[model samples]
Target: MSAQLFVVATPIGHLDDMTFRAVEVLKSVAVIAAEDTRQSIQLLRHFNIITPLTACHDHNENMVIDQLIGRLKNGENIALVSDAGTPLISDPGFKLVRAAQEHGIRVTPVPGACAAIAALSSVGLPSDRFSFEGFLPSKSSQRLLQLEKLKDETQTLIFYEAPHRILASVKDMAQVFGADRPVGFAREITKTFETIKKMTLAELVSLIERDHNQQKGEIVLVIGGAAKEVDLDQLKLDQLLTRLLEDLSVKAASQLAADLSGVKKKIAYQRALELTAEKEQDKLDRDLN
Candidate 1:
């Protein structure tokens, strides 16, 4: 049998989160490629796995791809791990995995803890459909711009935020997505100081502002999506437009219709114009008859 590449998931916080298979694979592999050797060493020491570890992080992953792949081709099973949660989830190892696949090397996942999924499972938000938007921009301006684009998204939005930038990011979320928007804030998940709460964006900002402790920790924010607007029935909307067209000009009728129905003025105006033309055609047909 050919050698395989195992992508292992280490514990994000608590050491016990490491899985049985993860420990077994780590021990059985010829070598382990870690995002940070120093950090991974502690976990290995705790588990008593003395597998030789090498660095395969974002900065040097590209440089070491050839070497890692050569080792795999030479019939050496290797395991890839990050300092925390599953690798390649806002962590490194993507390039190496791709390279392994390109060379037809089997890439196996020894799945366990992932901060995003771990938080999502317990955040009390709708988990049916969600978008994991890794991390927002650090700069306030860029972050706001990014939020502006997602303001209208209707699927639950999940984001990983740094401890230092949590306050500003939540404030920006309230500004663009609205203060009343619901959010699930999970901090230090699977750890001693774990906190998971569902609250409004405004309340979140306030909590982070008043309590400095909320600002610290590995943060996962599960924000409720934009409320889906219920559109008025088309027939009812058309009838309302026709009634208004009887006593109002197209522009005035459309403006009033938009205000009354909560539809855009441009859409109302186009419908109003269509109704007006239809009424005129009926009149001309009656006159001809």
Candidate 2:
């Protein structure tokens, strides 16, 4: 009989969030695979858990998976944990779990805290349908491009960001998703300094700039979904087309407007033509009248 693999979840920040079952699983496991041995040690010490821990972070995951599978085959129970939260979520351990299943070993989840879910639940954003975008690209250009791709995504977006990059990320999100888009910034979840603020992208940018201290801590950002409808009057449409035409040709302007406003391209094209004709006629009418 092969040993079982326990996918355990640890506290995101508050130690009390650590479940009783998770502690038991950690103590009973023959060996524990942790993303960071040093970080996991503190948690173990707090709970007086003496189980041996081995490093299985991104650097050594591929190499360690084989050894972990062998241990499970030998009927040695194992527990996998990240520095915080659940294993295999923006952490290392998927390969070992997959290998265990292939070898007919049982893999059980001891569910508990998750930063994304915790933030989303409390943020009061659209929880019905949401997409988790674990982390944005480090480079500014790449991050902007990534945000552009998701600009029109209807489902709410959740992102994990480091303290150092949170402000820049929020700025880029505002640029791509519009400054008025609602966003939730949850920082240092479950800790004494824990804060979750709901505001528009523009407001958040100003808030971060106003207080330098707001930039410190693990950040979970939740952006509201794309608008389902856009109300544009003739004047607004004319202004939009005029701005778009500055950079794009007439056909391109129509296409770009349709994409940005979620209006049909054919209709936008016709409107663009009408606007042009109206401008030309207005010029003629002014000359005649």
Best-matching candidate per lDDT: 1
Model 1, C-alpha of 288: deviation from truth (Å) = 66
Q: What TM-score does candidate 1 reach?
A: 0.80
lDDT of 2: 0.91
Q: lDDT per prediction?
A: 0.94, 0.91
Off by over 4 Å in 1: 234-289
Task: State the lDDT of candidate 1 residue by residue for 17-96, as single tens digits.
Answer: 99999999999999999999999999999999999999999999999999999999999999999999999999999999
lDDT of 2 by residue, 1-289 (tens): 7589999999999999999999999999999999999999999999999999999888998898889888988889999999999888777888888888888899999999999999999998999999999999999999999999999998999999988998899999999999999999999999989999999999999999999989998889999999876555656777898888767777999998888877789988998888778878999999998
Backbone clashes for every candidate come to 0, 0
Model 1 CA RMSD to the hidden true structure, in angstroms: 11.1
TM-scores for the candidates: 0.80, 0.79
Cα lDDT for residue 203, model 1?
Answer: 98
